[model samples]
Target: MLKFPNNFLWGAAASAPQTEGHSLLNGKSATIWDKWFEMNPEKFNNNQGPSDTSNTYEMYHEDVLDMKKIGMNSYRTSISWARLLPDGKTLNSEAIKFYRSYFQDMLDNDIKPIINLFHFDMPWWLMEKGGWENRESVDDFAFYAKTAFEQFGDLVHDWTTFNEPMVHVECGYLYGFHYPAIVDMKKAVQVGYHTLMAHVMATKAFRDSKVKGKIGIILNVLPAYSRSESSEDLKAKAASDLLNTRSFLDPAVLGKIPEELVDLLSENELLPEVEPSDQQNIKENTVDFIGINYYQPRRVQAPTNPKVPAKMPEDLYEPYDWPDKKINPYRGWEIYPKALYDISIMMRDDYKNIPWYVSENGMGVADEERFMNDDGMINDQYRIDFIKEHLEQLHKGIEAGSNCFGYHMWTFNDCWSWLNGYRNRYGFYRVDLNNHFKRTVKKSGLWFRELVENNGF
Candidate 1:
């Protein structure tokens, strides 16, 4: 049996727009998701949009009860910018009341609430003004972050400045998978730089407020592995890692941009305009902890020809397929449990073993209902096995002196994904979208309850 530390926090995470159903209600304004759905409804699976999700806005009290029933000691969720500051400046009283009640309900149940200031849901008004590409967005986001701290800091202690900053930069600016999709390399680098600047400014605001808590940023850290021992393959892997991982990791933790990445961007004329004072703020207000959202490892190989300055980072390196790699058949993602251990050791050795946690880790299946057994229960043994293997690897890392203190799964209930909508389910509790959003705990949910109760498997 593997046991975790006594204070190990076991829980699940979800975002505001993903879970909350009342998207436009209670004085809330439309976010990018709402506008995107309006312009392109066909982009979402089954034509399901963000207007109605799991109805968390109305049923949060019951949801908190469900969390307690699952034996979760902590819960991580984000506050919607569109909900609180509908126009990005004015405060919505209803939104404030709702969040206070929602957070209080969690604390009342003895569950620590870990709040993230920003998820992917940006206000429509802000996106119209060039989003993060505009330098003024840094101050706008800083104001929002300061307001959130002033209002809710007394109720919560653990705060994340941004959830997966790299994801927004890649998907929105470079990959064209999210809202205001623009395939521009220069804009991607600019948005990423400004997002990092916003994080630094928010950290400074938190410090100035004297709020008694830890503030960090969540990064989706996927380690890149070379296809072979050849120098070219190793170089490809390093480039992939620098773009996907270190772009946000180095600035958030080390408080400085990696010189190699800066040189590459500068050579290509894609380096963002950085103010002199911005570096000082970042260097002085580095995060107290780091959040790692590891799902899979990236397998890469050297480009076949002389590299042209590509518009997308992935275009610079070639993706490699391992012959005998384990696969998540439904999701089409490689299932390498050992990657978690490798990442933990990399952090311990290279990142100075700063405190961190597995903020979001889980599998998403296309049709989870097919796994349901008799008694109307979804016997999701696959999810249980997935968690078991990953946790075992995490326990190994902890035993080796890694400073990982918690593990929060991807989500608590099935909710609206950005483009996939309800196609993939990554929740402990199965949400019946057809039946008033009724939630049923899957077999894996019970398994997780036992895991938390025992603090191990």
Candidate 2:
């Protein structure tokens, strides 16, 4: 049996780009995803792009009601920067009207709306101006943040500056999985550095503007593990953690970058240019809390042959494939519940016990329709089991005194994913693509209701 503390926030998460469709309609400018899908439909699976994801823009009243019916007290979602401001300078009135009604629906349903500012959907106008790589984009994001705070800060009290900024750095720049795919380590470094700078700048604006909510960043923290206890392997782990986890974690939480990481980048001559006041600003303004989105762990060993340039991740470490690892068969992700406990323990011990929550955690299954019951509900027992196992670990972490306040699944509706499109479903309610995008709650959703009502199971 497992149980959570009193007043736990039990809910789910979805992003605007992944949920709100009508890409070019209603004065919404194209995002990187919209443009990239337009240019390279072949890149997406089955040519299914995010033309009309869950139709939340039109269906949000019904969707938020569904959330309340499922017993959710909180729902985390992002505001589309491009949708809110077509040019990133002037605000869109229709967009503001839509968001006010949408957020008011959440409040009317007695649900706390946890709003996230960015979720990798960069505006095309901003991208053309060098996106996060250019220093000017930092101020642009801050302005967006200030505007968001001014408008919706009264209605929403929980705000995150960015969700998974590292994904933007690595996917868009290093791995080229995203739009404007540039595969340069120097560009990657610059983008990553500027992203944190933007985060800090936005955080400063939030405090200075006297927003209603406690502002924070949502990081997909990958707790790194060494392949072996060898010195080289541990060194590789340090490097990997420094690059991904600590880069944002330390700055957002501790108000500083890891000195070791700075030294490494400096020695490699890959350090991004910084202003004299950046460090002091970071030092003064740290997050009130953070959202941790943990899906997997990073296992690494020293690269067999480090590149002479040694700029990319592979140049420093080799990602290790654990032999005895359990994996999710549907999505091929490693299933490691213990890592949840490990992360919480590390947060308790290493990070001064900062307040945090499990921001995004769920299982993605392909061909979920096969599990549909005759009653039209998805028989997603596998998803239930997945969430239960993770919650068990979370319970242990909380019992051990980690200041985790909530548990939010990856999504509520089967929304559109960027790279894979909707190939795999990770939602409590199945959104039918063939049936006018009908929304139906799954078996896991019922379980979620009971779990939340009971404070656990």
Name the candidate that leads on lDDT: 2
**Residue 357 of candidate 1: its Cα lDDT?**
96
RMSD of each: 1.1, 0.9
lDDT of 2 by residue, 276-367 (tens): 99999999989999899988778899899897667788888899999999898867889998889988888888888999999999889899
**What is the per-residue lDDT of model 1 for residues 17-75, given as tens digits with 9 covering 90 to 100?**
99987898999999999999999998988899999988999899999999999999999
Q: Per model, state how many residue pairs clash.
A: 0, 0
Weakest lDDT window of 10 consecutive positions for candidate 1: 306-315
Q: Look at candidate 2 and tell me the lDDT of residue 36.
A: 90
Whole-model Cα lDDT per candidate?
0.90, 0.91
Ten residues in sequence with the least summed lDDT for candidate 2: 307-316
List of clashing residue pairs for candidate 1 = none
